[model samples]
Target: MELISDDAPKSLELENISRRFGNTYAVRELSLSIAPGEVICLVGHSGCGKTSLLRIIAGIDTADRGVIRIRGEYVAGPSRFVEPEMRNIGFVFQDYALFPHLTVEQNVLFGLRNLPRQDARTKAMAMIARVGLTHLTSRHPHMLSGGEQQRVALARALAPGTDILLMDEPFSNLDRGLREQMRDDTLSLLRSMGTTVVMVTHDPEEALSAGDRVVLMRAGEIVQQGSGYELFHSPNSRYAADFFTAFNKVQGIYRNGQIHTPIGAFPSARQLREESQAVAYIRPSDITVTTAQSGLSGRIVQRVLLGEIEQLAVKLDGLEEPICVRSLDHRPPDTGEVGISIRSEAVLTFPNP
Candidate 1:
């Protein structure tokens, strides 16, 4: 697949959007644009407004203030609101939202009730085949696997000929292995159709691997938005860094262009203001453990063997806290005496309050 450029404009635009629930703000003055054919995943903890924003876009909920435009035509604003059915948008709910009493074909054709009987049957059958459910069209929702039921919901949503798709944790109900397979398959189908999608998920790995762009939300506001690689390597805030990956933090002080921490004195990346306190963050992969006498001293406290890597907890001299380090090769060290070293380039410092 060719790389997608940043300048493309097949986009969903939201400007100055806000939603409130009486005294509490659900979404606070948010603004963003998702490109055409782009799978933009909204990620945050529960009650962080990610779902609320998606609901607003789907016309299921009204925004307190803002303008929403799809392909440059205004669809939502303070004085104007489009009904959910007229928005020409498809929605896949978290629970699969299939009617238990209806057959697969009937469920798929449910949205086409107003159309002529022959036309609705033709469209529903075509969608069933498109979703690889033609063989099970006569069966009810309970007769299918979790993944199959999810496809039925997807086909039903796509039957309406909508280019925009909104999904809310569509795979949460599936088992782990099935969830991964469904995610890949769903993404492939949507991309093949050039469908623009906005999905809400709290999983970081899912957001990183499945989205063309990832938006990280916290407490009703967008904290960071960027491509997966960019956000992983260059997070602008501690929350983003901690949320996306594991990091070990150490308190230290900067003096004379170097930081003095429990580990040791290390050169700073940039000149620091005089006598400033700071927090240094380093990923578990960045620390190296060795028996060499030249490195900082620490004691191995615990060792946990994960499939691909082993996590070690170490208590260092002069540092009261324990730090975690991950290694692909596991070499058990003595619990009370093991030396560890910090890589100079992997250290990230933040201003201390």
Candidate 2:
């Protein structure tokens, strides 16, 4: 059993990876490069092919056309294919996938089969301890809590010192509180180990907060790839803009680099023909409620309290529906006429359908 060489290649590269099931393509001609020790999240709606792509990278599913290189060595290509066990990559499935009959210690030892008996046990115990589950090493999967089972799964996947780790919605099964805690704990461990990771998640907030880079996919192709802030703040398409959060879509006319809506005019960065119909997307949080004389005058017609945040629906003169505003003020005015102003920098515009 040897430690990973410091000079070993640490990047994962996929070039033109494609997979098809019958007449439908699960993954199109997709290509991405992951740097050493970088964490990348794949996010999209259901049936968007994120899981299919992960399986292809793991060697569980074959790619119809493409190249996969791990640690700078070709693992899947035209003339060569490496077995899953030989690829030195670890996978943590969504369900954890622990053997029901095996004890925690035995499960961790499964990945170190090639090592000598004593060495395998020693390494497995060390990993179990690293996950803070040393006291439960003899416990079977049925007897452990979900978080404990998650730790066991992580210990097993990491026991062999694999080059890259892949996770598919690893924390989705836990409760909200537990999910957040487990995610933070797992991230801390991965950061300390400096492991390169590729995670697939349908959760937008998780994708934004957890990954060094986020890859957003749609219908078997990547729509955008960049830091979370870049994708959220500077989305390339209307689809990308609508994916991250809720928006108050205002229909307007595009003229002179601005969108003129019923209530007010907002600047747009999108190029459009003059007088063309455009839609401005403003986040609920980006709308400011002011005194009656400050901005566009509107009457608050509805209010809903959402824990620390409050949602207010303001009815303007020309709009068919009231515009929603989210505010952090504990006791916001719920029944008065108010002025509304939008943040120009946060506005996203697209050509109306």
Candidate 3:
């Protein structure tokens, strides 16, 4: 991948940006900046204000507070508000939102109207070929598959050579296999062209895979923002931890800066008064089912076969709920005592909220 030079100008910036509905703030005091060729993904569960923030940045919705700048120039703020069409930004909608009446080539040509007729036609054909849809150039939206329509929408958004691209669940409409393929293709083209991107996806895995930095949001606020590995391995809160991956939770009493769980005592990040409650969240992938005889023992109660791995439900000596563990073996252990070894780095301890 071609890296944008450090000297490349700031592509997009938002200062204390916010937007409000009738009685609620969709986006509250959000601030972010994008480099010339950076890709940032805003992700969270539904109604986390990610898409609302995206709309605010794209000028489709006005901000109730704060300033927006593009390439060091003020665009939206208290004193200035740029219209959507005036911002040199491209938007790819969730459904692609192509013109039903227009052919693939015509839909792409629609965005290049600023150029001359011949130039627009030339650019449209080039974009059509670029996305590998040259054979479907004359197909209408209804005649094309969901993935084909998405390529058309992408071509239309990018044909005009915008400085920034904003995608809202660009591959959500495609099937699983096609989604992965399209994502790789889209990122490759964007990285190659050095266009700045801020994409919104509700899928946690998608955000982790596609973004250079992942920003997880919750109720109009940023829960955490960092590289995929950083957020996945060292999340700041229980909510952030649970959002990224499934966890087996255990409650323990806080004492001497430690939380004692069923498995063992674990260190806590924050100091809590003695006798207070603390919680330990452990991911299933971090627990290894072993033959070693010295660790915590549990009886395998249930096993589920998932194509690449088997999910096991183990009942510990005194815990009420069975602890879930994932194994790559084709079959789970025979219904018998199984020793469990938990990785220290995979356990997250927090004082109870």
lDDT tens per residue, model 2, 1-353: 12235455558889999999999989999998887788899999999999999999999999999999988899999999999888888999999999999999999999999999999999999989889999999999999999999999999999998758999999999998999999989988987898889999999999999989999999899999888998899999889999998899999999999999886788889889999999999999999988899888899999999988999999988888998999987564558888888787888999997
**Cα-lDDT of candidate 1:** 0.88
The TM-score that candidate 3 achieves is 0.95
Pairs with backbone N, CA or C atoms under 3 Å apart (clashes), candidate 2: none
Residues forming the 10-long window of minimal summed lDDT in candidate 3: 1-10
Off by more than 4 A, model 1: 1-8, 256-258, 266-272, 332-336
Q: Which ten contiguous residues of candidate 2 have the minimum total lDDT?
A: 1-10
TM-scores for all candidates? 0.92, 0.95, 0.95
Ranking by TM-score: 2, 3, 1
Candidate 1 lDDT over residue span 130-195, tens digit each: 889999999999999999999999999999888899999999899999999999999999999999
> What's the lDDT for all of these models?
0.88, 0.91, 0.88
RMSD of each: 2.4, 3.9, 2.3
Q: After superposition, how far is residue 286 of candidate 2 from its true place, in Å?
A: 0.5
How big is the positional error of residue 50 in model 1, measured in Å on the Cα after superposition? 0.5
Give the C-alpha miss distance for residue 60 in model 1, angstroms: 0.5
